[model samples]
Target: MRSLTGFRITAQRSGVAIAGTAAALLLLTSCAGSGEPAQEAGAAVAEDCTPLHEFTTIEPGVLTVAAMNAAPKFHALSDSGPFTGIDATLIPEFAAENCLEVKFKPMTGAAAQLDLREGKSDMFGGLILKTPERAEVFAQTEGSILYETLGITSAKDAAYDTVDSLQGKRVGTLSGSYYVEPLKAAYGANNVEEYQSDANAFEDLKAGRIDAVAWQSIQGFNFTDRDDDYVTKILDDDQKYPELTVLLENNWPHTKGNSAMTAAIDDYYERAKADGTVARVLEENEIGEEAAELYVNGR
Candidate 1:
């Protein structure tokens, strides 16, 4: 058995439904065509991709991408088709490069991974990252972004700063996130609480239900930047935590043994990296180099 290479991810927006009266069919069709291109956040002009010409995909000449709906990164509006974010926006480049049409499907985390395994989708990506075990089952590309854990607390309450300080209080983080175990280890299992989404965790924090919210640095920054009621803080300076960093890799996965598909993904990643596409996308999304440095270098 291979890595299964699939696990849970946090939600950005609720449901796969469009929020308004978007032209459902037209949007889907337009999203698949060449007329609507991916966001021009990357510097590279992707060259023609021909690997899929002979590759085995669920849909003939169409690249089926299984993704979750998340705002500012990927969105499948109520009926507006797929728009916004890295995965949704990158459809055109995949289509143009591979000489194929693109189709984006919204499904639960388990279902999405199942789609890739069953060949329902050519690939899938999101808050998903790669592990050594997963690599055995699915070939992966380099991570486009980095991830590190941090803590957030209410602005009115400055009682908590580090994990040790929250020993007697409740700490919140997204359920099924990689940070869960590490946080539990740092703050004690009895003190940890998990939420369905970032919004939920922050809601608890602002309401003073929890002493602090333990989460990835980006997540901590993302919400605090939006509402001044909360504040962001780091724990890398603490001596107790030495290896408190990881990169949240968003790699596309194909079925096991699909060497051609794997090669295509890796090749594109190299080109995309060299062209500054990765950096540009992160910048546009407000994931600055400074934040990434904090994760990698722990500065």
Candidate 2:
């Protein structure tokens, strides 16, 4: 709900996992007993961080994060007891920079959001789209990545160029997603099939159970990056369906009223963008350049 324009943030990173491996578990436990603030990047001494300590988290010197079980390139709970994907990497870096130990809790759907609202968790780790409805309930950080919804269809079929064009066609989307209702409104409710996961939606599309799949552009690319049978493209925006047409931004969600945490995380992103860390992380995860370059223009 707050704005973070022109903020400055700088923090140090101890050698940690970039590839989402067992090293993340080491990063989490290695600093648990230190109880001291993490040093700034390349600093000779730690800055006075009494203010950071003044703000309360679910636990002292620990940031408990609520994470979804699986979301492909965004986040997944690895068997190694560490999270894998973009948010997984970024969140640990944020914790390390802020001199806090990190703890992850597996949750999904409304329960995940409720965890943040009730102070059961300090933040949500997966990529959360920035929207007014969410902002009204949570203290969302600045735009970290650009998000665009794409329409996926078989290569042999014509693409749905606009939202309304899917009116009579069967379209599948992730259940509980922000686009679900708008998609159902465009493609008649009876024509829309909601799946619990993207894998299920795409499988139904491939088997002709649905005519198309509406999903995140990045995640869709992960599905169709090498397959020639499917193709993905952004659907043109229609005034009647602005939620589907307008470009969206993604950010980390924290409990509302935690202004200090919001400012700290925002500062972290601003510095990460300026130093090329953000783009580097996106690239490592195979996200497109469009998203890597989006932090320059805030929504």
Which predicted model would earn the best TM-score? 2
TM-score of each: 0.68, 0.75
Q: Which stretches of candidate 2 lie over 4 Å from their true place?
A: 1-26, 29-54, 69-72, 77-82, 107-111, 142-156, 294-299
Highest lDDT among the candidates is held by which one? 2
The digit string of per-residue lDDT tens for model 2 on 120-207 reads: 7888666776767778888987645435444444443555556665677888876656777777776778987887656667778778
**Clashing residue pairs found in predicted model 1:** 3-137, 17-78, 18-77, 18-78, 18-79, 19-78, 49-97, 73-85
RMSD of 2: 8.6
For residues 3-27, write the lDDT of model 1, one tens digit per residue.
1001112224442323232222211
Give residue 104's error in model 2 in angstroms. 2.3
Instruction: Give the CA lDDT, 0 to 100, for residue 103 in model 2.
Output: 68
RMSD of candidate 1 to true structure, Å:
8.1
